[model samples]
Structure formats: C-alpha cells, structure tokens
Target: MLKPFLSSSFVSGTRLIQRPLYYTKRTMSTHSHLDDDCIFCKIIRGEIPSFKLVETDKCYSFVDIEPLSEGHSLIIPKYHAEFMHQLPDDYLTDILPIAKQIAKAAKFEQYNVLQNNGRLANQAVPHVHFHVIDKPNTSTGLGLTWKPLKTDMDSIKTRYEEIKRNL
Candidate 1:
C-alpha cells in the first residue's frame, strides 16, 4: 500500500512539471505576403488604389483610406514584417524619417505617430505599419481616454526625488 502511494506521488509530481513552449519554426506565412488578398500588399504592389504621399527604396507612405483626420496616412516597409519587434533595425530607421515627411506634407498643426503590436493592442493588420494622423486641434481630431488616479502629491514628489538620486 505504501509503495503504491509513493509511486502515485512521484508520477503526479513528474506529470505536474511542465516545459515552457518556445516558437522555434520561423513560418514565413505568419508574416505578410504580397498577395492580392492582403490590403497592404495590394497598396505596395499598386494593385489597389492609394493616395500616394511618399516612397523610398524599401518603404511607402500613403494617405489612410479611413482617415482619422483629413491627412491620416500609413507608413509601411516594402519588406514584410508582421510585428514591430520583427522589423530589422535598418527598416525602422528608414521608415521614421519618411513618416515625418508625410506628417509635414499633410500640414497638420500637430500629429500623432502610432503603431500597435498585436491584436490586443489594436493591430488590425498583421503587417507592420505606422499611422501618421493629423491632429489639427484638441477638438475635431482623435480622442483618448484614461482613468484618473488619485495620489498624494507629497508621495509623488518623494518617489521622483528618489528616482532622480539613482539617475
């Protein structure tokens, strides 16, 4: 009876131990492909109509079809990167300056350059892209909401002072 009990416990412990899952296979399909089915790919291929703003050797900027404002545009790398983290450093560097140029061309008094990583972060498209939106005024543009938190000013000041000391 004791032997059976001990054996059961050992089996249970061994079974309870779990190995973490690692994504080893680099499936290229998980990234964007230049297919007719893909909207961004169509934009890249010039198959679908887009209001062209700027283009570089490895990137393209076009006005957003669904504009958050009058001058909303998207910046996409010619090479497919599904997520922002997956993008090569060179691709990142090349795209940002072009995005700034688009924002300037739109003549927005203020602009918001935004990107989302995953579905939970509001990434509608798997293909990596940046949204350069015109925010002309506080009113008539995109709005953001945040929950207000109540905190003691003295405590906040103390925390900032401590962080500054370490810096």
Candidate 2:
C-alpha cells in the first residue's frame, strides 16, 4: 500500500509520476517492486515505451536516450531501490550478468560500468540502474578525471577497524 508523490516530470515521451521521499520494504511478488511514481518502474510496467534491449524475470534493459556513446545502455532491476546498497541480495544476482551480455552483444572491447547512488553522485533517477557506457575510444564514452586525495594512514586504519567491527 504505497501512495504516489505529488509532482510529475516529463522525459522524452514518458510521464514520470514520482513517489514519496521514503519507502518501505515488503515481500516480493509480481509488481512488488513497482514504484508507481518511479520512471524506471513505469518503464518496466510498460507505462512508458522504451527502445528495449532485453527483459528477464528480474531485470530489464534498454538503450540510453541520452547516450554517452553509440551503444551506451542501461540495465535496471525490476525491484526498485534508490541505491544499490538498499537493493535485496536476490535482485543483485541478475544485474551484472545481464550487463555483461549487453556489453558483449554491443561488441564493447572497452567500457565503463557505472552506477551512481545519489544526487551528489549524479544519479538523476531515483531507481537503481547500471550504465554500460562504451569507451570505444577515449573521446566517445564516459570521460572523467579521478581526483584522489592524499590521506592519513592512521585515520584510514582507524576507519577500517570501525567498519570491520560493524561487519
């Protein structure tokens, strides 16, 4: 029993009805992951038309409308989660295998499998989706500069111990 969020956004030909800020977990069934307001959920449910590439019981994939390269694509789990950490273990199984299949079919010798968890990470959509961006050449696909900061080993060791304790 979920309710729709108040606002809507239009993308391409899809009308994305948004969900509330908070979500609760529930048992899995057909449409159990259907976030009525989520655009990816809507695509999964066929409320929006997509240039579909593949669909399995647990996942669906399609070409990215705004692709970084010629064959840039996305694979999303049928079960909706705003971030990967929130996604159930069962749903995690199919994602990478399917992405691999897509990369092979596209003949992408080099590529980037990108998933962003939040707005700060540039995740425009709320649902968890994995991007298979083709890096056929340096100029075509996802281009980025990885800026790494110098860190204190003592602080890093302390943080690692703290996290290990939680694990």
Candidate 3:
C-alpha cells in the first residue's frame, strides 16, 4: 500500500517535488532467510566488528567505516529489514529518537538523515540503515545537494495527476 511520507522528510526544491516511495524501489522479501546471509545481521549479532554508539531494544547506532564525512554514522534495526518501508511498525517508532540522540551527541545543530532503498538509489547494503550526517558547520562534513529536474508545466502536471490518481 502506497502512503505519504510521515512528515519526516526534508527534501525541498523549486521543482522536481519528492514523490512517495520515490527512493524505495520494489520492496524486498520479508523473509527470515534474508537475515541469515545479511552482513548487517552479522554486525548486529557481534559476528562482525563495528564502532558502536547506542544499542536500544529495536536498533543500534554505529560509526560508518566508509564515511562520507567525519562522525558519519549508521542507525539500523536489530532485525533484518532489507528496505526502509519493509521494516516493522515498531522500527518506525523507534528510529527517529535514536537518530536524534546520535545527531545531538555528535554536536551538530543540523544534519541529514538519509535512507536509501534501492540499487539505483544507492542502497549499497541490503539491510536497512539510516545515514546520519551532520550538516555544514565548518569544513568538517559533506555538503548535500539536490538539483531538481527542469520540466515544462504540462509534463509536470501530467505526472502529478497520474501519481495523484494512483494515490
């Protein structure tokens, strides 16, 4: 079931508005087997090493080894939900608070909480994880950028109407 983003999104531009499920591609299988072979599962299970931050009942936060910037970190659910939308309801309830804690602890007043869901969207890990990157306070972090596509009004309206009808 397609649904609107739960008021957590920060994407903005003059055009090329964000669509629901735009980043999430075809949903991955909600199978227990996905857990067995998942590297994030291994990390969560203590089979692989990660610099830990916070471990709560539903998820954990840790430093990203291949960080795009300093203090870059990842927040992941304990269970192996391959996509963000595929995660259980409890995960949605649990994630934001912990992410906030991470951003605060890193001493950033502003940050980007990024979650990618498909190969095309740059979801390198099959397991669900949120990238917590602090925004520019100095020359210490990455500068996130988005160039919205320029399209004619007719084409944009046609696309909007199509998605609106579907919704």
Question: TM-score winner among the candidates?
Answer: 2
Q: For model 3, what is the alpha-carbon lDDT of residue 29?
A: 36
Model 1, runs deviating above 4 Å: 1-36, 147-167
Worst 10 residues of 3 by lDDT: 19-28
* Clashes (N, CA, C under 3 Å) per candidate: 0, 1, 0
Candidate with better TM-score, 1 vs 3: 3
Top candidate, metric lDDT:
2
Once fitted onto the true fold, the runs of candidate 3 whose alpha carbons sit more than 4 angstroms away are 1-34, 137-140, 152-167
Of candidate 1, the 10-residue stretch with the lowest lDDT total is 1-10
Residue 20 in model 1: shift from native, Å?
Answer: 47
Model 3, 1-167: lDDT tens digits are: 33323223333575444323112232223324347678888787677899987665566678999987778899888768778778887666557766776787788777789989989888999888998987666566666468999889999999999999999
Model 3 TM-score on a 0 to 1 scale? 0.68
Q: Which digits, one per residue and each the tens of the lDDT, describe model 2 over residues 1-167?
A: 43323222234566654423212342236658679899999888878999887665667789999999988999888888999999988676666766787788789999999999999999999999999999988789999999987899998999999999999
> Could you tell me the lDDT of residue 30 within candidate 2?
69
* Candidate 2: Cα lDDT at 19: 29
lDDT of 1 by residue, 57-161 (tens): 456678888888898889887667678888777567556666666666567778888998999888898889998888887875567777787889998999999
